[model samples]
Target: MALLFEYLPLILFFVVYKAVDIFWATGVLIIAAIVQLVYYKVSTGKIETRHWIFAGIAVVLGGMTLAFHDEQFIQWKVSIIYALLGLSILFGKLLFKTNLVEKALMGLFSSVQKEQEVEINIPNAIFNQLLVLWVFLFLSIAVLNLYVAFNYSLDTWVNFKVFGLMGITFIAIVFTMFKVYKFLPEEQ
Candidate 1:
């Protein structure tokens, strides 16, 4: 599925974190991002600046992790990415004239019935909140990983990574849907 590639870094990280070293996982993430960049450029004929920035940061941070020989560096990767994304969304709302998340997600944030009208503030608020949520989620995951890694086997962490994150995400999706449905315009 298309989502496979979209989340390939995560998949590679989870699998390789157990089987291989963190350095190998970092390499795979960098390589995948590189391949994706060229693929998107060639196929879509336009490069997303955001992706390029993210890939570049990952490469630099990954290289640091390998160079300094510290696994903690690799773990900070998600935290930094989450913070950056949260800041970006905030930036879009406060500084930029456009809503970055809304522009990027296009119609994904809008309801089926509201083809009639979308209040810009609503999308902006939702996206800003989502960004903040990501920050908290990533930080919590990082802390949980630390606690689990120190206390138990890596296998437990891996299992938690897959099932726990997925469960939380599913719950968030359901909550968002409930909110959207509640706010949808009534049928005429």
Candidate 2:
């Protein structure tokens, strides 16, 4: 089931007209994502702030794409969102004591027994810094995607859509894992 969810976007693009314009198959995937978000809210009875912000971005940027009738604008939308998210994470964590990523990521660690014990002790600043890093990682993905979509071909974009994002994400994961592993705290 998780595998299905993961590959669903790439599968849709290929099963349809293959991310081609006029059809704007990516738009359909976005729409489906929106619907899933709505259903999640109904079922869970909680709406995360980050998801709301993401929806706002999608609407505004997607509307911009429609209003201007420019594919480039639309193509660039994901990058803008990624860059903005990255910047926000950087600022929120480094300058302020906020952590959008930590807050948005509650579900992942919610089940851990030590989560509650360590939650309060965790440095908000570091979480914010981590958010910044994660967001920048996402931004890298957006930029790479744009490069392939424009300079190469839709097929290349589709291929990246399948593998490129994962590759970049894997890089982040490995970096973080190595950092954590190498920097084990000295127990007092």
TM-score of each: 0.68, 0.66
In model 2, what lDDT does residue 43 have? 70
lDDT of 1 at 170: 81
lDDT of 1 by residue, 1-35 (tens): 76776677667777777688667877877787788
lDDT of 2 by residue, 1-188 (tens): 75575446446645553536523654654575576568558878886676676556656655666667655554665677677777777777668866767665454444542534443234555555567679768777677767877998756765676677667777877775453442333332
Best by lDDT: 1
Which residue window of length 10 is worst by lDDT in model 2? 179-188
Give me the runs in candidate 1 sitting further than 4 Å from their true place: 97-106, 109-166, 183-188
Candidate 1, overall lDDT?
0.65
